[model samples]
Target: MNYLNKLERKIGKYAIPNLSLWLVVTYALGYLMMYMTPGIISYLMLEPAMVLRGQVWRLVTWVLIPPSTGNIFFYIIMIMLYYSLGTALERTWGTFRFNVYIFGGMIFTVIGAFVAYGFLSVTGGLTIGIGYYVTTYYINMAIFLAFAVCFPNMQILLWFIIPVRMKWMAYVYAALTIYDFVTTGAVGRISIAAALLNFLIFYLSTRNYQRVSPKEVHRKYVFKTQMRDAEMRHSGGVTKHKCAVCGRTEKDDPTLEFRFCSKCDGNYEYCQDHLFTHEHIKRS
Candidate 1:
């Protein structure tokens, strides 16, 4: 376990239920099985047939399957890398967003499998979308890429030879996935689609996507500026809406700012930054 994991455990119970640790544990188990048995290439290796055969569990489980641990050194390296990524994403996105990204990939993989099943049912083409190897892997890569995009300066020791920036590494990983999709058939294609979908979701989910009137935005800025100035004087600033759920000051993000909780119908202070960015609306 990493320090972050331990800290999370000690500080609160939130991290345990998080998808990152579960994914890592699943991968560890898969890798262990693969190591103990040498000849068979099963879902542990991301085979499609096992996935399609109502091994539907693989739909979500395949994500935990580790990359081929060909050698001792490589296995250790991959394990470290995989767990590191899990911890980073868990901390960055919090439990809910991270769960959405992971489970979204699983949903995409299952949908891909069903689509593949439909094609096979009709065209009677070769078996496809057996294991969700591609989907799970790409989802992981997409999350890492998202983290890299947000924190480009983050670094890691690559092959124990050189230090590399995360952004460039993300680009390289994406290119490799594209290359695999073009070269490999079926399963790879599904993975590519799932990964691309994750990226699309992440990209469309930024403050930049907000749409609000310029007057409101200016007011927000002024409000925040005033708040800071007033804080210096130990006095309350001008009125600015604050989210009851998330303590986001609606001083900067004017657009999409929340007010008067629609559900509660009364006092509310949520900014738009907290609304779309959170899992406030439960699916009925």
Candidate 2:
């Protein structure tokens, strides 16, 4: 099995459901805060210098900052677009994998912030706030990129007018990102790289792995053969349902009702006559 499959088996249960809704809610709260008390936002930025001085809440509160603060109409449209993309990704990738992708991007962004802070502190004095540059903007971009990769041919209206495929949109965005990275400063480059690192890793890992590849086909064949063999063994050689207590099966008495004991140590079935009377089995 793949590493992701192993991880899903182990910790998938802890994944948050409807994570996209929560992200939208955070953006809404940030917008409200921006309109109400803009000054408070300075305290919520992901400033590593501030964190070292004990303002550690900046690490998390930075995510609450909206990607943009201009043009309310565009902001609403952007939020709706991302909400749709995120929800679709969650449904396609499953909650746990989607959680990993998002949280991975966020974690990488945090690390990038720290790296940029260190670089600036060593070369020049801490000149400006790194938090301003290292925001969730790239993280949002990563989401769109992932959606594009997953549904490249899916069409959506561009500017609510022209219909365009996801791949075409992704290409445009990618070109813009490349241009931005080339023209921007070191901190901006680092932030962009960090934010999209998750998508990069995911794309590289899955690019060559197709759904109907030879390995997958072999796996399915083996699974089906095993299941068929088990079914044949059960049908041709053994009784379908057998009683552990009375050693009786459906063949012995067609009307016999059998049930596996829930409290039994193992696969112990009993006829209705002995089901309630037999002591529950316990394994050490």
Candidate 3:
């Protein structure tokens, strides 16, 4: 963990990973469905338009639909890969932001589908092939891109031995996404739109969103507290000096060290740990 994270933890704050379980469950279920028969995914699922008509399950289950279910083993491999991607996203974006990336992509694609429907209704439905034919995979890509932009030098295994920089990963994914959008075969294109939407939304919402300097964040809260305590200790009053433990008093200085009493006196000194150095006090 970094310093900022440490500080946040010290303050009893935390960033939770949001909405990742759904992706895991949805895709895993799809993988299971494929084992039973081929084209089962489509059969169990309805086209977006069909869903708009009445098959409401389409609206939700649509996300579980994988790019392609190759073989039993192949889907297993893909599930493992996508899960790795999911974990990376959770760590990079705290729960709150990651959910935004996910739902934002879903929402944008849904909007695109409705918009595409409006156009198709005017004329007729063109074969955009399977999926929404919109770039949705990129929603995921854009989030990774944001993380890469923030931490370019971060390293990851391309495939075990081939060490790669996060920046390269983002670039390579972005190229594939763009190529898929332009080319005829749309493989996981809806994901591209979703990823792009993540980028746009984050960029727009957090144009001013930059990591807070850890020092500044600490000073603002922690240092402010220390200052308040220090001020109270120095305030003008008939300051008394006596040890509640031994009643030792320095009459001349009236500033002898005496730790506060947590019991009877409620304010006399001879702290619970006299031998243990207390850094919170100022010595004459």
lDDT winner among the candidates? 2
Residue 138 lDDT in candidate 3? 50
The better-scoring model by TM-score among 2 and 3 is 2
- TM-score attained by model 3: 0.57
RMSD of 3: 17.3
Q: Across residues 31-140, which tens digit of lDDT does each residue of candidate 1 receive? A: 67766775433544344466556665555555555655568777776666766786777787676556656666667766766565565667777665355345355666
In candidate 2, position 252 carries an lDDT of 90
CA RMSD of all predictions: 21.5, 20.5, 17.3
Off by over 4 Å in 2: 209-284
TM-score of each: 0.59, 0.72, 0.57
The lDDT for every candidate, in the order shown, is 0.64, 0.92, 0.59
Given candidate 2, what's the lDDT at residue 269?
93
lDDT of 2 by residue, 1-284 (tens): 29999999999999999899999999999989988998988988999998999998999999999988899999999999999999999999999999999999999999999999998988995736898887888899999999999999999998899999999999999999999999998988989999999999989887767667998999999999999999888788478788787888988999999998999999999998999999899998
Best candidate (score: TM-score): 2
Global local distance difference test of model 3: 0.59
The model with the greater lDDT, 2 or 3, is 2
lDDT of 3 by residue, 210-263 (tens): 446676787688978999988877864434565544555555345455556343
CA deviation > 4 Å runs, candidate 3: 1-18, 44-46, 71-78, 127-136, 185-191, 204-284
Residue 243 of model 1 has an lDDT of 71
